[model samples]
Target: MTEERGDVQELSDFELAVYEAVAEIDKAGGAADIGTLTAQIDRPEEEIWAALSHLVSANHLHSTADGYTLGPHDWAP
Candidate 1:
């Protein structure tokens, strides 16, 4: 399927936090590892993981051996 783009503008607060956490990892040149995300979002691990799962289902994120990362279409306006 084609990639999604800029689809998170209307995300809920929790999803937005998840996006920001992922963005932080991207900025740091690392994957959105669960440990990194939990630290960045300052939330419980399970909560962050649930958000990440939603992101994955929504096509805003992808998973790899390294960890989760922003999907290709995430930056689209």
Candidate 2:
């Protein structure tokens, strides 16, 4: 799917950071907690959680009993 931001066609700084964090989690083959994600983005827990929630809402992340990982469609390129 494609996202349109009116003038800009890509994610903003915050979104990019969040996406990067997610990608890193994918690269590491592990799950990251709110604390780790916050540290990575230098943001508060609430902020990171919000981003994660957005990802989840967008079907880019999956929240399991264990933790969060890339969703089924997230790996598609």
Candidate 3:
């Protein structure tokens, strides 16, 4: 399946991983911090951070100083 967002025709596996990581953290009642994500995602720290930025830009995820969260907009079809 594919996820459509602003300028994002499809999400890469890494990007989806970042999204799920954020969802997991959010479900745990904590912000999805980079430090925490670094431990959960099996990718380079830079790649994970980049994914986060991309997802947030695409409105596939949301973030604040506190950290990341799933987007409010419906993400799944």
Candidate 4:
């Protein structure tokens, strides 16, 4: 679910951070799983899960059986 261009700004800071975490992991040739996200983000695991869910819903991140990755969108900050 790719969000529209105008909706890109609707992403919250934590959601964006989650998305960036996935991006970084993908860049490093790794999948952004719960453990990786938990290690990279200082927040509690529950908060990280919430942010990841929001990011996936907002189309900023993609979730697969492996883990999360950057979603299909062209928008950049």
Can you give the lDDT of residue 77 in candidate 1? 31
The lDDT values for all models are 0.77, 0.66, 0.80, 0.78
Q: Arrange candidates by TM-score, highest first: which order? A: 4, 3, 1, 2
Model 4 over residues 1-77: C-alpha lDDT tens digits?
53443265787787778778889888777679999889888889999998887777766677889898877766452
- Evaluate model 2: give its TM-score: 0.68
TM-score of 4: 0.79
User: TM-score for every candidate vs. truth?
Assistant: 0.77, 0.68, 0.78, 0.79
In model 2, the number of clashes is: 0
- Which sequence of candidate numbers ranks them by lDDT, best first? 3, 4, 1, 2
User: What's the CA RMSD for each of the models?
Assistant: 2.8, 4.7, 4.8, 3.1
Give every collision pair in model 1.
Answer: none
Instruction: Answer with 1 or 2, whichever has the higher lDDT.
Output: 1
Off by over 4 Å in 1: 4-6, 74-77
Screening candidate 2 with a backbone cut-off below 3 angstroms (N, C-alpha, C), the clashing residue pairs are none
Candidate 2 lDDT over residue span 17-66, tens digit each: 78667767866887767766777777777877877777776666677665
Pick out the ten consecutive residues of candidate 2 with the lowest summed lDDT. Answer: 2-11
Query: Looking at model 4, which ten-residue stretch has the lowest summed lDDT?
Result: 1-10
